[model samples]
Target: MGMHKDQRACRRVDCHDRPILSYGHMVRIAHVTDCYLPRTGGIETQVRALARHQAASGHEVSIITATPGVKRSGTEIVDGLAVTRITAKIPGDLPIHPRTRHHVAAALQENPVDVVHVHVGVISPFAWGAIRAAYQLKIPTVVTVHGIWGPLASPGYRLSELIAKWATWGITISAVSQVAAKTIERAVPTLGEVLVLPNGIDVQDWQLPVRQHDSSTLNLVTVMRLAPRKRTLPLLKIVKAAQERAGITMRIHLRLVGDGPERSRAESFVHQHGLKNLVSFTGRLDHAGIREIFAMSDVYVQPSVKESFGIAALEARAAGLPVIARSQTGTTQFIRDHQEGLLAQTDSGMASAIASLAADRALLAQLGEYNRSTAPEQSWPMVLARVDEAYARARHLD
Candidate 1:
């Protein structure tokens, strides 16, 4: 039939809606992803953190991924969780195991899990296969979509549903943000209303002592992979535009954190624009390194419009830095235009926001004060509570 059963299953579970949390026994969760540690990104990082938090919370958690191991495929205990790598020797080191369904099913059969929590991106064949395998085995499944599906991707998912009906029956679907969930609703309409499972962060880890920066020079920082879709080049352009708008009164120095294939292109843009003095690439840094940078930085800038959940932005906010990011991104969930930092609708608007912050130190200090004082609601405890709810829903569906 229809989604009648699914509707009943989700009748009480609204998106991010808190129900009376029933603290219960340990849940044996199996996180399935196409990628994991050593291969870092949003989904991989979130999955790892979620699994770790669940494990820390007395739940027995495991991970099944197609991302190749250091050598071959097998089970290994990573950070106390059993990680089963179902990998294939493929070119380009793609996280695509052709026999994902078989391996996933075999792993679960050998080691029973309460739920198969599949972390999916736009093109996660291994994750989709895990969903199918879980469905075939009549195991409870929850699919958390980690990316915003555009027009092409939405239709592509619908076509995939037509072929395999993966969005049907026992699957409980979710996304990282309302913006992302809306896209999934349009993409997998048959799944009905998708759930919102926001990403979590340990605030204490990112929380830095609030302090004022030197007014002579503005140290702007952004943490993101230098990818084309991430708009790294445009961020530099925005920095240049803001410098012009800010005039010679205040010097702006930008540090681009993280590295990707677009590093060379971004470097070329920096050189061509004569921004070598103002812009510097730190390559990639760990949490401690980023915190050290934030300790000395003035503002955190984000320019990606396709951001599903601005975890890095949240980290900067937690680090007590005023954030200036795109309005279209999921970062706007916590960051209001004048509240946390400034949200811009266009490139020029972002530049204007940066310039205004440079000119108006009081406003910047106010935003920074608000951010440091009022903590984000998307903390690990709240996120784990949401995870428990979603897992309960999936178990109920079975």
Candidate 2:
């Protein structure tokens, strides 16, 4: 007699030839975040990368995000991952509404999932929902704290902290960075055991074509949102100082690619500093556009006083650009002093570093070479292995 499809016996051949069921068997992961594509930021990029990697590894992955506009609705497949954007009502002018949690919870109920990973921050309504759903279903949940919680000392922040403490696992993007990790741990003591997994980039995509050295112009680029906290004014000051102090008269061009609330302010500052010919602002470009910008540039600078993981810095290194970043935050962790790149102390110091590197082409090339060599360590393959191991520990499978 023929055996039923659902009632097939465990014969020797069937057991030996077929893949064995392990702990990671057909893992279905639901990534819940506040903002996603169509809205770009560090956390959005990181979650999207993780989802793509997970989907590529033969796991089913889906992302839930809040849709503010009428145009974005239903499911769409992006980069081999399924994305579902739900319609939310906005009572105020806020980009996201409180009802996002209800919509996300309903979606989770409709689609039973294995694990739910939450990216919690100031705007994480879906995170709140995902954690509550996971708790109700008794499924393992992981929370990645991507922002600084020190600014959130209000009642809302306290409530979010309570939810975070109950998470099965807490992951911080820059655990190796002492400043970032300590800041989070101080606010929420329960997050002391948080796993550290630095952000990563696709090294293959950033490979630049070898070009002959151009002696005429020194290309300087900074890829960041034109915001106040990023401190773009200081970067412009550095450019001015480089021109004045060096006296090299080498053509220095600054490419600023990103747009934000501070764009007008930055433009005014640039005008005030008479950097019209030297500085060019390319308002927010996609990854491919940014990659092209990186390829054309000789050096990358990040002057942000507040940075979590510095993914842009990693991308710059992958593209073989020598990076000079602020010495305060997560950027300092990735850049080794005088080895991979240089970390400047002040605006004057940053200007000095830029001037010194521009004067010496050989040193710039050497730093770029060293940075490219170190790119593999910050790739997604290495970062994901650490993430999987952390998930195993969170689920008590280890």
Assess candidate 2 and give its lDDT.
0.70
- lDDT at position 151, candidate 1: 67
- Candidate 2 at 122: error in angstroms? 4.0
Model 2 TM-score (2 dp)? 0.83
| TM-score of candidate 1 versus the correct structure, residues matched by position | 0.91
**lDDT values, one for every candidate:** 0.82, 0.70
Candidate 1 regions exceeding 4 Å error are 1-23, 152-164
**Can you tell me which runs of candidate 2 are displaced by over 4 Å?**
1-25, 69-80, 91-95, 99-102, 149-160, 167-179
User: TM-score for all predictions?
Assistant: 0.91, 0.83
For all predictions, the C-alpha RMSD in Å is 6.4, 5.7
